[model samples]
Target: MYEYVRNPSLIHEGPLSKARLPVFLVHDGGGTAFSYHLLDRINRPLWGIENAKLQDGGWWDGGVPAMAAHYIELLGKVMPEGGDILLGGWSMGGLLSLEMAHQIALTAREAKNREGEAGDSGASTPKAPIFRVRGMIFIDSIFPLRLAELVGPLPEEPVFLSAEESRKMKLKDKVNLNMTHARMMVRFWQVPQWKDIPVPPTILMRAKEFVSRDSDENFVDYTRDLRLLGWDQYNEDHGHFIRDLWEVNGHHFSIFDIKYLDDVTRKVRKAADKLDPPDF
Candidate 1:
């Protein structure tokens, strides 16, 4: 079980504004579940996250399916009985969320059938899923398919980081650092594929990396493509690392910028508001 850092003194400081945020966050290769601490203003009542699980230094070998299963179990434990919830993540977490949702839907269907055969009343138990998701949010993460396009087909074998870089890049920072699994999974989806997701109102917060002495002319185009693919709304910022709660801005390739985080977090709040359940 993943233990959470719940400090009473810091209770008023986490990003859980309402009673339950029910948000799932996937941190960067070098980050942890607490990576979203910078956006603490947006109180999230329910948070299911795992940090640095991918930073194992052994490439993409961090158990993606296993992590997903853990969160699904967490949802079973914490989510209100027969309650719907929101799911989202950043980078690899985001990708994992997508896969998790797909698997969860399958599980729910199978469970419903099993219960029906056991004489469970159809009126009491809904045939569809007990929990319907509001939307999925992706923040500054890599899209496996997009990556395969940028870099030729991923190597089938696991790619380990050289010993020195592994020491510098802690385990928390290398979650899903390997490309092998991503390559294998990327082929499952076809391009222009947002239509398949059953959820509504998706958001994709993309980051614009400002390479030194280089013009990112393709940034706008790529962000546009992401929007067309599935994100209901997309915000592009200039930061590589997840924004800090103490400080809105973050460093990208050693360059710090604050405006991007400010704008993106603001947008996240707005998007979240739109996620509020429909009036009864």
Candidate 2:
């Protein structure tokens, strides 16, 4: 029933190599798969992950979780055998990565359990392929509930609340004037389930920006929690998304910048290299 999931077409800077495992890169809020063209600029072979119905008005109305699941299903197809997939996202996409990682880990565990039972019971259960997700990378994403109070209260529609409550809720998140998308991301991130994401995730954040508005004490507390969780946190001197000066439509999110994109792709490569099965 999940075959409807699809991967977006992409333009590539270098030749596609089957030797390299595919990295499925999802875009942030208000972004299409095309928005991740920076991955091409970084000379990485990434399958740009986007929703097929993104052009339709109601595609994102169901909230990020639904879209996240769609992307994850599509990712399963491109990911190589023996667990060689690298999953990464920016902003809202980072939240999606968390959800995807949780699902992948759950799927992998269940598959292993089924295999063991087949031998013990002498049943003819076919060997199911293991969905090995190597690593998850988060860039400039918020910690749970950290920025919600600063962004003000979440609205009562779609991501903010429910779609039925206000038809304009999704539009509110799409508003580029203020940081509405950032606010909604932080609000839902507060859910305890997000903390349960079962993967070795590296969080690359704009350190100064996320904590600049808060007191030094609060910043320390926040960083402490991140460290305690064994999160590999890195600092960036840019906005939540990197700066992209060549954006055709006057959008200036930096996560699309060549320099920033290169930095992240390298980090993802290094993390993947360290995976137990060796994702070379």
lDDT of 2 at 245: 11
Residue range with the least summed lDDT across 10 consecutive positions in model 2: 242-251
The residue-by-residue lDDT of candidate 1 on 1-280, one tens digit each, is 2134421012123333235435555443343555455554554453535532234442333355554555566555444353555566655556666656665766766676778776755444444325556666656544444555644455556655676777787553554454344444444443222333343345555554433334432322333334332232321221111222111133222211344545555655555555653232
Residue-level lDDT for 36 in candidate 2: 61
**Clash totals, every prediction:** 25, 5
Summarize candidate 2's per-residue lDDT along 99-200 as a digit string, tens digits. Answer: 666666676777778878887998866543356565655555544445555444656553333445335545434343123443454466423242333444
lDDT of 1: 0.47
Q: Give model 1's TM-score versus the native structure.
A: 0.60
lDDT of each: 0.47, 0.48
RMSD, one per candidate, in order: 8.1, 8.6
- TM-scores of the candidates in the order shown: 0.60, 0.60
Model 2, CA-based lDDT: 0.48
